[model samples]
Target: MTKSIEAMWKEGFVNEACLTAPKINDLYNRKSQNIVDKFKDMFDINIKAVIAGSLIMLIMMSFIGAPFLGIYIFCLLIPLIIIAKMELKKSVNLSKGQSSYDYLMNFNCWLESSIETYSGYYKVFYPLFFLGMAVQGIVSQAGGKLISLLVEVLPTDIIILGQPYYLVVAVVIVTLIFARSAEAIYRWDLNIVYGRQFKKLAELIADMEELRK
Candidate 1:
């Protein structure tokens, strides 16, 4: 009788384990579907906003006698469009349940291509980034010169305080504020992108674990 009881318990445990696998799989599938749906909504909103903002800027520039600025904006925007297209393609591929290995291989290839393209533009981008600081310096110096010229033209009563000193102080404050804000934005974007990538990697690892089980 004891032997028969032991055999029954073993069979029950096997049945329970077998039932749990499908439950776990269903849960994972539902979670993955939710994530994909969220991404789709976000991507749609982002693309719409980008297109609308770009069109508005283009139209405004034409009316404001700044058509050249619009053209420059288009030139800068093309690379971003290409990047978005690549990312969208990858996202679609992932959503289709393509094999993870294949998806990763394609993603790596896309990244390599992007890096090559960016390498060609690295010279220009680096200079542009530093140009902000250069511009700040030029603006501060110009402010000082303007203040000096104004002081010369004004009557002594109007020049009660040292104008150049005040102008320099104002320029320094503006420049520092601009620099700090730009740096903060850059860091925030970097962190957000990195975090998303990390989350995707974690999900892939979990999927692999499920497969192993």
Candidate 2:
């Protein structure tokens, strides 16, 4: 005919939890949607970045070649294009997953791979990029405008060693310089381009983990 005070409080607590469950789920759901928006925007940015890189590479190609430089620039661009495609796939895969937590975890990993990919590319791109310039210097030094201008300006031979071999030595020196500098340059570029998105994705992953718990 009557309930105890303890029983009443327990029943009220259970009722509140039951009533609030859907709202709780809805709140967590917003986290996933927000993550999706951030990642989609990131994907678009990556696409634009790749296109811009391609244009710059094309411009460089117009000037960079003694054949060796042209070939090297072409080779260097292939990995960048591949990374761009992979980034797009990551966004598309997460676009409409059923569970927020699932996609957030996936996105966290995707971000990690992106960093790894760029770091790996760094170890490759910087040296090769400068190699094109070195080759141009070598090819143009003999009879091109640079040499002609030097003759007109009043100078002696600038050869540090023999002709062809000296130029080869210069190329080796340029390659070594960029090899040492690659990590710093790569990190700088990475910070500029993807730093904000990486941090946001990590935070979303953390929030999703906490919410699921």
Top candidate on TM-score is 2
How would you encode candidate 1's per-residue C-alpha lDDT over 1-213 as one tens digit per residue?
344644443343334344434554445445555555565566556566657776776788678665655555555556655655666665566533643333444444554454455444433433444444344334465746765676687534432234445444555576555555654554465447445853774575455444544
TM-score for each predicted model, relative to the true structure: 0.47, 0.64
Which residue pairs clash within candidate 1?
Answer: none
lDDT of each: 0.52, 0.65
Full-model lDDT, candidate 1: 0.52
User: Which numbered prediction scores highest in lDDT against the true structure?
Assistant: 2
- Score candidate 2 by TM-score against the native: 0.64
- Kindly list the per-residue Cα lDDT of model 2 for residues 1-213, writing each as its tens digit: 686654444343334344435554455558667766776676777767766776676667666445556556767877877877876676577544455566566666766677777778877888978876655664664545664564466555555544444445667887998898888888888778768866776776665455443
Clashing pairs in 2: none
List candidate 2 stretches off by more than 4 Å.
Answer: 1-21, 59-74, 94-98, 141-170, 180-184, 210-213
